[model samples]
Structures are given as structure tokens and as C-alpha cells.
Target: MKTFEARLKPLMIAGLDGEAQAWRAFLQLLRPALHAYFNRRQFQGDADVEDLVQDALLAIHAKRETWRRADPVTSWCFTIARYKLIDHLRKSGRAKLVPLVDDHVLLNDGVEDGAVRQDLAKLLEATPPRQRRLIEDVKLSGYSLAEAGERLGMTEGAAKVSLHRAMKTLMKRVADREH
Candidate 1:
């Protein structure tokens, strides 16, 4: 019985060299290890674990070119897996694990209105001038996109694109802050 590294190295190299069969076999071999890795992390259910395994595998495949032959394949693979797990935890709103004893204390006070306004202003300040105005008019003022665009001297389509980009940037900033 060969060690996992011995078995995987050849397949990984072959896969990188564009061997279709070797690539398929490599993924098949990785699935069980990936499944076990996620299961040990106590994911919500088998479905979540399986989903993460697939995500890790896809990431590994996509980033294959970045892998150096001199590095331990397992380390590279697990790094990708760890990132996928973190992304899943963040997107699922489970990145932070609160203790049961602290639950009551955590719920004591809601966010202050002033704090929310300050945070909103901070996020808006990072946007470009045009996008800032579009966000303010369309979102904060509750104006229709067309109305906001008319007020800002832009077409409705332009306003929509600007707002979408601004919102995406804000979301990324918030996600980064959370992590």
C-alpha cells in the first residue's frame, strides 16, 4: 500500500500535463478525502459537506497551474479547502461561533441609529462621486431608478449600473470587515 502522496503525485502531475483520464481519476480519489475533511469540521449536514468538497475540488482544478511540483500537494490542496470552508462559513453567516453563555449579553442592546448612519456614510464615502449620488438618490431617498437618473442627469440604465457597482463594493467591504 503506497502513501497518499505517492499515489497522488503521479496523478496530479499527469493531470497537469493534460491527461484527461488521470485528471478524472485524481478527482475521484480526492473526493473521499475531501468528504472526510469536511465531515470532521462538523458541517451542518452531509449535503453541506459534499457541497464544500465539490467547491474545493473545483478550486483545486481551477488553480492547478499555480501548484508547484516541489510543494506538498496535500498542503496545497488543504489550503484551498480551508479557504472554501471559510467562504462557506462567511456566506452562511456562521463564521463567528458565539458561546451559549454569552448569548444573553450579546442581545442586550441593538445597534444604535447613529452608529448605523455613520457606517453607511463611511461605506458611501468609498464610492465614486457619480455612484455616491446615485446610491443616495435611488436607495436612501427611495426614488425610482428612472427618477434618480433624471435628477442626476443620467439615463436609467447608467444609474442602475452605477448603483450595482457601488452596492457590490459596499458588500465586499462589509464582508472583509466581518472576516
Candidate 2:
């Protein structure tokens, strides 16, 4: 089964090589995840979220040549999205200073960004690679279970069951960590 990076990187390369279909497919695959990211961060309305997604896409298109072939495309795309989010927040005066961090943002979300990162990193490290990938692909990357399952060569039911178990395991691990 191919990892997300494994699957996405090639399409990105083909897009760079002027494959119009692959380029559109690559952006289409990314739209859901980028939309989810902005939605979770701020909620001006659906239009605002859509604006952010389009903004990120345009930025990605403009900066397409800057991406190093050896680096992770997802990381590069999210970096651009994050900057766009920060810019939006600043312009709206909702956030004066938003620190760039991983997994969680430094917002009014009660959980400190550092703590969220620590807990997330710990839980992710404890999960098996397949389960970890499921979590990342489905939950974080906004892919449906069926979509993620197809990528991993599993049935949707199997993917759903595995993700359920993964969440349970993380809950238990979090409880044990608290103890």
C-alpha cells in the first residue's frame, strides 16, 4: 500500500512536468484537506473558508516551481495554507500574533499549542504505522475512510474498524499518560 506522500508526490511531479490532468488531479486531491484546515482554524462563514482554500491554491500555483522535488509536497502546501490563515487572521484583527506550530494552532482553543503537539506526537509515536497512517490520512488530511482505504488497499469497513480501534488506543494511552 502506498503512503500518502508516496501517492501524492508522483502526481505532483507529473503536474510539474506539464501533465494538465495530473496537475488538476493533484490540486483536487488537496482541496478537501485545505478546506478542512481553514474551517477548523476560523469560522467567518463557508465563504471565508472557501476564500482561504482558493487563496492557498493560487499561492501553491504561483510557488509551484519553488518546491524541491525531494521534499514533502503536503508539507509545502500546508505551509502556504498556514501563512494564508495567519494573514487572514491578522487582517481581520482576530489574531495579532499567531505562532507557527504543528498539529494545533495557538488560538483561543484552550489547549495550548505546545501541549497539543506534545500529546499528539506522543500518541502518534505509540500507534502502529498503518494505524498512524489511517489517522493522518482520514482525520488530518480530510480523506474519507473509503478513499484512504482504497489507497491502503483495504476495504472501507476494514479502514473504519481500524480507525475506531486506533482512536480507542489513543484514548487509553492518553488516560495512562495522565496517570
Candidate 3:
């Protein structure tokens, strides 16, 4: 948000200029905002959320000098928060982070449908049948999560977890292939 650029940018600029008090103030203020960001994202627990907040804050501090003066401070801070979250998910051996791709991703891509479907089939081959169905319905077939869940007789939350696991399985297969 431009408001973040307006408010936090000055504090960061001052801190970069060797103004200790302003730097401390920036950290103090950024802490809560980062906390809220992690709290919303953390799937494990409160302690983990707190740990992630600390991690992001430390990363932000360590990289303060790299901040582009023209960029939004909040954007830079939240980028660190997102990476911390992805790292936590990876180290915890949980599912890969859900992608932010649009639901209609298949519609716009120029790739031929046959090739795409073949690739999708290969990637999804090892996934469980129900999970494969869920992935097809939600990710490829243009169904809402709730709709897919309903079709499969799963609760929405269960569907979400299942979809996450299916994607994780696909990612593992891809990684194994690359190696």
C-alpha cells in the first residue's frame, strides 16, 4: 500500500542514515505488522508464528541496507515473511506452499491441450485417486474448493489438506526427475 511507503519508508531511510532511534522505532512498529502477517499464514501453532515473526524481523534487520529507497518497506518486509513461512513449511516436512496461480491458468496458456494433459497425467499419476480427482476438479477443471469437496464427499478443510498433499506429491516427483 502507498500508505506503507509513506509511513515506513521514512523510518527505514532514517535508519539507513545512521539514525539509531528511528531504526529502533522502525523495528518496534514493524514487529506487530509482521506478527499479524505470520499469524495469518502460520498453519502449525502460535509458537511457530512467533518464531516466524522473529525470523522475519531479524532478516529485515540484517538486510536493512539492501532496501531500495524507492520501494515499499512493507513489501520488502512481507517478502521476508513469506520466505520464512515457505521455509518453515519445508523444514517441517509439510506440504509445499499452495501456489498463487489463478484458477483459469489452463485457459490462457498457449500450450496445446494434449501435451498439457499428458504432462498433467504424468505428474499426477502417483497421487491417490481421490486426490487426483480433487486436483483435477479444483486446479484444472474450474471447480471451486467447496464444489470439489462436495462432489467427493469431503469437508472443505479436508479437501484443502488433500489438495495440498497432492500438489506436494507432484512437486516431489518433479524434483526427483530433475535430479
Candidate 4:
């Protein structure tokens, strides 16, 4: 796949820019390097790794203007990424070095549960756009019915109806999985 950076470089250079896309491209470019750094430093926990990556990306975007044009973008990105990783580790007290586990035990039953969760995520992704948005806003993100309705440009009653329908659909899908 052609990268966002590769596809959009000319536009960026011309100052006909996509700062958000540029940030996304920068994160994609930095992923491997960040992963290697975390692996080498023995960072554990999927949630921790994802949070660190997200925080680093946010900082990189915020500080993008400070990065020197003369310096290589990779180096600049890694520097910020590394600092973010270290900061998260320090704040969370999850930095203690432990002997690495080559293989971790997973309960045999967990495989089915994991598959169900994956399917649920996909099902949600495939949901009708408006209902999906409403469910995410009201249920997943804990937005109040009024708040969700306001954001979705609907009356609160309408939002509640839409959300109930969305949840019923999801429940039906999950229930069908058993059979």
C-alpha cells in the first residue's frame, strides 16, 4: 500500500497540507520503531502499549512545528515517542524490569471468548452509520441521552429509540452466534 506520506508529500511540500493525515502517516512510519523500543525495553500489557503509542502520537502532532526541517523526521519522531513511553512508564509505575515470559498461558475457553469479542467489534463496525454513532456516543462513551441526541441532531426520545434498536440488533447477532 502506498503510504499517506508518499502519496501526500507533494501536497505537504506545497503547503496545500493535511496536518491530520501527516500526523497519521508519521504514526504509521513510527510504529515499527516504537514496537521495537517497547519490545527491547520489555514493556508488557496490550493496553499499556496502545496507550503509550496514542500519547506519543498526540505529543508528536502537538509539537510538529517545533521539529526542525533539517533533521530527519524518523529521528525526531522516535525522540518524542521514546520520551512519551518513558513518561507513561514513570507515571504508571509499570516500568519495573521482569524476566520475560516466552509463552503465556491462555485458558482454552478464552479462544472462543476472544473470537466472540472480535466478531462483536466487526459487527459494530458494520452497523448502520447513524445507529452506530448513537450507540457509541450514548452507550460506549457514556454520553447522556440528551447529549447524544444533541450531537446526533435528534430528539432525546429519538436517540433513545435508535440506541435501543441498535442494542437489540447487536444482542440478536451475539445470540445467533451460540447456534
In order, the Cα lDDT scores of the candidates are 0.74, 0.77, 0.73, 0.60
Candidate 2, pairs of clashing residues: none
Residues 88-118 of candidate 2 have per-residue lDDT tens digits of 8767778343433343453333222333444
Among these predicted structures, which one has the highest TM-score? 2
Q: Could you tell me which residue pairs clash in candidate 3? A: none
Task: Encode model 3's per-residue lDDT on 41-95: one tens digit a residue.
Answer: 5466789888888888899899998878876566577666666777777787887
Better of 2 and 4 by TM-score: 2
Q: Candidate 1's residue-wise lDDT over 51-103, tens digit each? A: 99999999999999998998667657865776687788878888554111122
The alpha-carbon lDDT assigned to residue 37 of candidate 1 equals 65
Q: Which regions in candidate 1 have their CA more than 4 angstroms from the true location?
A: 96-178
Pairs that clash in candidate 1: none
- After superposition of all CA atoms, the RMSD between model 2 and the true structure is 13.0
Name the regions of candidate 4 deviating beyond 4 angstroms: 1-23, 94-179
Off by over 4 Å in 2: 96-99, 102-179
Per-model TM against the reference = 0.54, 0.55, 0.54, 0.41
RMSD of each: 16.1, 13.0, 11.9, 16.2
Q: Which should have the higher TM-score, number 1 or number 2?
A: 2
